[model samples]
Target: MRLEGKVALISGGAHGVEGEMMGFGGASARLFVQEGAKVVLGDIAVEDGEKTASQLRDAGYDALFVKLDVTNEQDWENAVRTAVTNFGRLDIMVNNAGTGGPGNVEETTEDIWDGQMDVHAKGVFLGTKHAIPEMRKVGGGSIINISSIYGLVGSVGSTAYHAAKGAIRIFSKSAAVQYASENIRVNSVHPGFITTPLTREGLKNPEREQFMLDRIPMGRIGDPDEIAKGIVYLASDESSYMTGSELVIDGGMTAQ
Candidate 1:
């Protein structure tokens, strides 16, 4: 019960459905509830989000679903309100919503760049912005922004993705410095090639899967549950003195 009595709002929580593949948010929601926290799953995928929340409820956990477009301020407001209204208060905010940006600089267009920024950069900004006030109400809270290994290290492609995720990394540091006095901890999580719905399609190609495996020092892809455990540590009091740090769980991909 590391997160006992706490409440969390996770964007992109509908990345998977019941009895199907799961993403970081969905896995985090399950682990959080199991650790004794009430959870609110927020996403643009209404059906998947509702099914996930319902699945949790059926399993006897406290959970809810909200229609949230992370790029929209009104939606952020509504999601935050839903958390406070239903669960009483918000203690954690996981900015986990994202879209893939696969082109290089020359191939990347205005739309791709802007879209990447809107979801990865702007979305994290709004989530942190709104979560701060609510966190202030509770004396303090944890804000976990989901970044990528691409954020820390550059790749051959994904120019816009690297830019957006890099922004999140520095943005988290700035937020941590600004809010440290208030006890509101802000941090970022960077994941490697993981087995999620988003990556499954890409990894289906034998060569692509081999390419990823070859890069990882662990010689294997990561599981959502592994990343979820890290999130749990950050959300719980176990990391009480930690803030403005980057928790990288990439099977040692970045260490090289």
Candidate 2:
């Protein structure tokens, strides 16, 4: 019961595809509920989101699903409002929704760049903006932004993705400092080669899978559950004194 009595809102909280592995937000939501927190799941994947929530409720966990397009401000507002109205308070916010940007500088179109920025950078900003006031009302809260290892280190491709994720890294630090006095803590998580729906399509190529496996020092792709454990730590009081930090869970991919 590390998160006992707390309430959390997780964007991108739907399980990816019916039979596929879960995403970070979906995995995190389940962990939070197991730790005794009521969770409000927000995602645009309505069917998967509702099914996830229904499963949790059947298991006797407090969970709800709200349609959320992270790129939309109104969606963020509604998601946050639902958490508060339904659960009474919001204690943790996880900006974990994401889209892939695959292209080199010349190959990257203006639309691709803008779309990447809207989803990764703008989405986190909006989630933080709305979450702050409510967190303030409850004395303090934790905000965990999902950044990529690409945010910290450069890659041969994914130009727009790197740019957008880098924005999230610095944005998290700025938000952390700005709200530290209010008892609100903001941190970013950097993941590498996780086997989620977002990366599954790419990993289907044998060469691409080997490329990732070779790079990771541990020689294996990480699971969403592994990252979720780190998120649970941040959401709980276990990390009360930590903020403005990067919790990298990449099997030492960036260490090299």
lDDT tens digits by residue: candidate 1, 22-86? 99999999999999999999999999999999989999999999999999999999999999999
- Candidate 2 wrong stretches, greater than 4 Å: 16-19
- Over all chains combined, what TM-score does candidate 2 have? 0.98
What does candidate 2's lDDT look like per residue over 1-256, in tens digits?
9999999999998983335689999889888999999999999899999999988998898999999999999998999999999999999999999999989999999999999999999999999999999999999999999999999999889999999999999999999999999999999999989998788889999999999999999999999999999999999999999999999999999999
Model 1 TM-score is 0.99
Q: What alpha-carbon RMSD in Å does predicted model 2 have with respect to the real structure?
A: 1.1
| Number of the predicted model whose lDDT against the real structure is largest | 1
Which residue pairs come into collision in candidate 1?
none
All candidates' TM-scores?
Answer: 0.99, 0.98
Going through the candidates in the order shown, the clash numbers are 0, 0
